[model samples]
Target: MKKTPHASPAAAAFVLAAALLGAAAPAVARDNPVDPVSNPDKLDYRDVEARRPDFKEPFLRDGVVSRPERFREIKPGITQAQVLAVLGQALKQQRGALGTEWDYHFKFQMPQSANYLVCQYKVVFDDSQAVRSAVWRRRQCLDLLPR
Candidate 1:
């Protein structure tokens, strides 16, 4: 059988695919340079620094602290595996301050949502350079409000 101009299989398939993909594509999120970062309101670091609320943390654990049920306790010398084990259960972030005195913060995102909260934990050591208290210290839940 000869294919008609209006009944071309290639064109029909193209049209069907385009229609179906067009309907489904909007549901996906595209992150291009043109695309704005999600949740501009949630950007709090700048705001916090701007206000300059004395960064002085008197106590070792100044912020909220939650012990992970599944993660293991911080033993005498924290290795990447120990830290990663807790992080694996909690949030994920770019590994930083590997040797600095800076607080290692992780952003644990909330239930399949765009919400991200901060969890702060520092690797501490004694004067003898022995890791005496290296654990997840303070965790400030950024997305405390209802979704």
Candidate 2:
């Protein structure tokens, strides 16, 4: 009688899994610029600075703390994700049966070392996840709304 080596069930399963994964690996590696698992060093960082609001823009510095004009881009039909892309992130969020709301706080620059003005920007979103409205208000800063 001749004896022959046979793969166990587990060993056969491992080999089949490896073969399938290996076949798909090349296709994934070809198009992706940065591979978190195999080639993380190639990850791009060029957009990191661009995504930040520029300090040179005075409106951004005084109005919303950063990128106040971005608020103007918001419209009734834009989604939550689109709003995030424009506004970076909200300082606080509130959700209710009517819709969701995001708030960002801003501080005013005043003279004579008096207490600075504080303001809040509110953005509301409907159940459909679309922007319903955006507003900024402060009782003290009524004279200098965007200052």
Candidate 3:
């Protein structure tokens, strides 16, 4: 029987080492990386990026959903009507020795957490129906609450 040609073990190992070295070599950026011939219509990438709008405004908030930013406008002595305009409506209300307290609950979401947080904004109004105090607090979801 005719013997088939086969590379020696040493030759095979050398070939493998050469291939690994070539792959491990760091890639060098070409001076003229863009191919004008391949791309018939050459476009300046930098110019396109420069024309794009860079938004710097805040996208996340820490207030109620209806109008979170309005919370900042709340202050003592503000009429109940004004608070209502800002927070929409209280989820629960009750009259106490201190004053009439209103409860505002909202589902607060944070970028880092996978669960939704429960936030409560309690606004206390004096007998005159003017806000006397406002308090805000946040708690994790019921499922996440520690026993």
Candidate 4:
């Protein structure tokens, strides 16, 4: 067998440590306080109950399916909130993506773990629509609940 290029253990450890140190870190959310909408008196329950949630807003949730089984390794019918929770962590790490908004078609993928759901969409935009009509994949599932 031909001798492979061998790195000394100390050199390898230093390289690995430096590589990790150089990696981009996720930004933390600011702790500034803001008023909550749940002031109680701010809403009349009777009136609020009569109104429907607006679906036209961007990033507003449409629905969720748990562990949908259409894609390879994704479970079926996972909820929208669950998907968002998983993706949100990844979004913090990646710099290229400005934001993500999705409407689940609920293709019914089954036997998926609590993590990793594929969302299919028509378009993506950044700060401006600089990247428009661009379809892509978003990695989620860091905090996927144990099935």
Candidate 5:
């Protein structure tokens, strides 16, 4: 019978390292565009709004009363997977690996009244598919955040 050839120790190690680095490539490729010194409130929302017409659902137009706590969990530099964990999938947009933005409609219960305020939320991603910034169509909706 013919004997099988085994890889040398150094070759085995090189192959292992390559495999590990390949596995980590996706995470390493994510880009963080947030400027730590700037106000998060100032992020531009127009870019997301420009794509609003792509969605077919009216919920994004009318807004839904979602739990305010979930929105608060989102932060800059997080990966799309993390955002998916916090907010689940975007309401009506099909977010692919190359998609640059995700949109949502959220309404919050007022602090002292029964009225619910409708708001549009947008999350923008860089070409690397990492979270760049998040914005609200109604700036006042930020008040819903817990102090």
Candidate 6:
């Protein structure tokens, strides 16, 4: 009679864990597919609106004004770390690294007026986590750009 060898208890546990994790991988990927966008390289507010019809900008915080110059620094292909350096942290509503979109509430002073215009800024990231495009919720916010 030939004797059969058995896996050690620790080795068996490791194999079981590996099998369970391997089985879950596909389902996880399917459940959280990367979001797709039209013209990912040139996404705009219209695309955002099309994908998030019910999305609304959060209320602006008092005394917190975003500099237009800093916003100008945000360009396509920039990394998230660069964005953080330029714009600080995004709004709490943003899902951080787990999400592809980061939202910001910006308030700018109206030229020669006491009131401030609040705009929502959105930064879209590609699958590689690089900035793909940026847009403002309102078209009028473009006026903030320096001529």
Name the candidate that leads on TM-score.
6
Global lDDT of each candidate: 0.43, 0.59, 0.60, 0.34, 0.69, 0.67
Clashes of each: 1, 0, 0, 21, 0, 0
* Candidate 3 residue-wise lDDT, 1-147, digit = tens: 999999999999999999999999999653323333322222111111222254443322233544345566788899999988888888778875567888766664544676455555567888899988776542222223223
Better of 4 and 5 by lDDT: 5
lDDT of 4 by residue, 79-136 (tens): 4344445432222222333333332322223234533343332223344423222222
List residue ranges in candidate 5 displaced over 4 A: 1-60, 92-99
Best by lDDT: 5
- For all predicted structures, in order, the TM-scores are 0.30, 0.43, 0.46, 0.17, 0.53, 0.54
Model 6, span 1-147: residue lDDT tens? 999999999999999999998987864232211223312233333122223644455532432586677777888899999999888787743433434888777788888898888776778777787887776655566677675
Alpha-carbon deviation at 7 in model 2, angstroms: 99
* Ten residues in sequence with the least summed lDDT for candidate 6: 30-39
Distance (Å) between predicted and true CA of 37, model 1? 35
In the range 28-129, model 2's lDDT, one tens digit per residue, is: 233323433322233221111323557455443233544333556877889989988887688778774346878666665564566555555567788788
Using lDDT, rank the candidates from best to worst: 5, 6, 3, 2, 1, 4
Q: How much is 66 displaced in model 5, in angstroms?
A: 2.0
Compared with the true structure, what per-residue lDDT tens digits does model 5 show for residues 1-147? 999999999999999999998987865333333332332544433323425676775443456667877876788788989998888788755453435778777778888999878776778787787887777765467768775
Over 4 Å off, model 6: 1-63, 92-99
Clashing pairs in 2: none
Hey, what RMSD does candidate 6 come out at?
Answer: 17.3
Model 2 CA deviation exceeding 4 Å by range: 1-64, 107-117, 139-147
Clashing pairs in 6: none
Scored against the true structure, residue 96 in model 4 reaches a CA lDDT of 34
